[model samples]
Target: MPLITIIGAGPGLGLEIARAFGQKGFDVALVARDQSKLDALAQTLAGEGIHAQGFTADVSVPATITNALQSIRETLGPIDVLEFSPADRTLESVDALKVTMENLQPQIDFYLGGAVTAVGAVLPDMIESNTGTILVTTGGGSLAPTPARGNINIAAAGLRNWTLNLNSALADTGVYVALVAITALIGGGRPDAEPAVIAKEYVKLHAERRDAELHYVAYDR
Candidate 1:
């Protein structure tokens, strides 16, 4: 069975994607900094008969993520798909705009550096096998500039461009890279932006293996 590693697995889109991929017959490796949460999620997936394991790692640390991925490979198998998601949004409000540069750096590191580390951990194996998938979850802020979410926008924009370039370079190698840009709130703030609905787009990205980017936006206005 193929393996999918989800970095920053949580209660929202992360869990949704895990379940979505799990339904498609993919063994899952959930990576996050919290072991207890991971255990709970793993248990939940287990109840559904999905083979899932959790690995704890702070995405800001490359060594931790690399070691975790290595452990996952040893226990489950080589990762066929890697899902990159941010653990939290650092600059969440425009009113709280007095944040210093130091605080902002971690957000960039989490989004841009974290993806680089995770991909680097698995890309070599994917290259050797000449087949794999990389899916990045980004926000519409990356597409359109937003002063309120500057941190996320900057980091996500970097990741978005990086994924596109990586896709171009890996096109002939059979390693597909794609980005899912969420244009609205994920959990039904908008009619079409439901988590379940977004999860399908991820499944389609893996199955179709054609598109390099998907914009998931929902509005009821």
Candidate 2:
């Protein structure tokens, strides 16, 4: 079975992507900060007859990420598809930001940094093995000028460009690096945003090609 590692796993898109791929018979690794939440997701997946494993991981914390990945690798074997779908901070304007852990740039970096670092570690194995897919979920870099969601924009842009650079370098070697850029609001449809259709489009991009680097919306894909 194809083993898929989902980083930044949260409630909405994260779980939806998980279930979507899980239906395709992939062994899904659910990574999150809350063990109980991951456990619950894993249990729920079990009912679908899909092999799922939960790992307690904090995206900003390097040690926790390494430990969690190691644990998941031990439990479910090597990962074939890597999806980074972490839900950190909202892409709110600076003026709209209030005081909270989720209101800061460091909070964004915590998950972003962890995801990249973990991917760095895992890439060597995938490269040596000459296979695997790396899918990074875009936060708010889809806008032309980009969203002013504090540091999340920075981290998300980093992920987006990093995937491009990495994909360019690894294309000949068979390591597929791609992006799932969702420009719509988190609520599926806000005043004027459609996240679901954008998400499904992302899935299609990956499913159609082995080597594809795509952007979600309002930008060159």
Candidate 3:
């Protein structure tokens, strides 16, 4: 079975995504900061007859992420699909005038730096094998930035552009890269943002090898 490594795996959307691919017979490598949470998630998947293992790592730390990927490769074989989700999602409105480097740096490191580390680790193998898929979960703020959340928007935008550029560089190499731009409040108890519903879109993205982007809205326009 193919392995799917989900970085920043946690509750809600992450778990749902795990279940979605796991049910499809994909061995899952769940990476998160909390060992207990990862173990619990793995046990739950095991109960459902889905193969899953947990690896603890801090996404912002490149060495930690690299180590986790190495351990995962030794345990679960090479990863076929990589799903990256930023662990820090706290949104604080910052004044455009007051936005200092200190305020913006955290988000940049968490989103952009973390993505570079995670993707770089597995990309070599994918390139050598000539097959792989990278799916990043980004917020709509990245596509349509607002001054109200300038820090997050700026960082997210950088990550989105990075993914697009990576995809361009890897074009025609049998590796597919895509983004799921979520415009809705995920796991906010709304129908459209439902974890299971949103997860299906991810599965579809992987199976169909669709375009480079998907805008997932939480409510009807």
TM-score of each: 0.93, 0.82, 0.95
Which rank order by TM-score, best down to worst? Answer: 3, 1, 2
Error of 1 at 82 (Å): 0.5
Query: Per-residue CA lDDT of candidate 1, range 1-221, in tens?
Result: 98899998987888889999999999999999999999999999999999999999988788999999999999998999999986564444332265466656777788898899999989998999999999998888778777777656777789899999999999999899999888877785765777777888999999999998988778886
After best superposition, candidate 1 residue 7: deviation in angstroms?
0.5
- Off-target runs (Cα >4 Å) in candidate 2 are 90-108, 189-199, 210-212, 217-221
Cα deviation of 169, candidate 1, in Å: 0.6
Candidate 3 segments whose C-alpha is farther than 4 A from its true place: 89-95
Off by over 4 Å in 1: 90-103
- Looking at model 3, residue 30 earns an lDDT score of 98
Task: Report the number of the highest-TM-score candidate.
Answer: 3
Per-residue alpha-carbon lDDT of model 2 for 1-221, expressed as tens digits?
88888887766667667777877778889998898998888888888887887898777678888888788778888878888776644444342244345554674566467667878868988899998788877755633345345445655666677777887888877678887666655654452243434446546655764545554544322
lDDT of each: 0.86, 0.70, 0.89
lDDT score, candidate 3? 0.89
Collision count for each candidate, in order = 0, 2, 0
Given candidate 1, what's the lDDT at residue 16?
A: 86
> How much does each candidate deviate from the true structure in C-alpha RMSD?
2.1, 4.5, 1.5
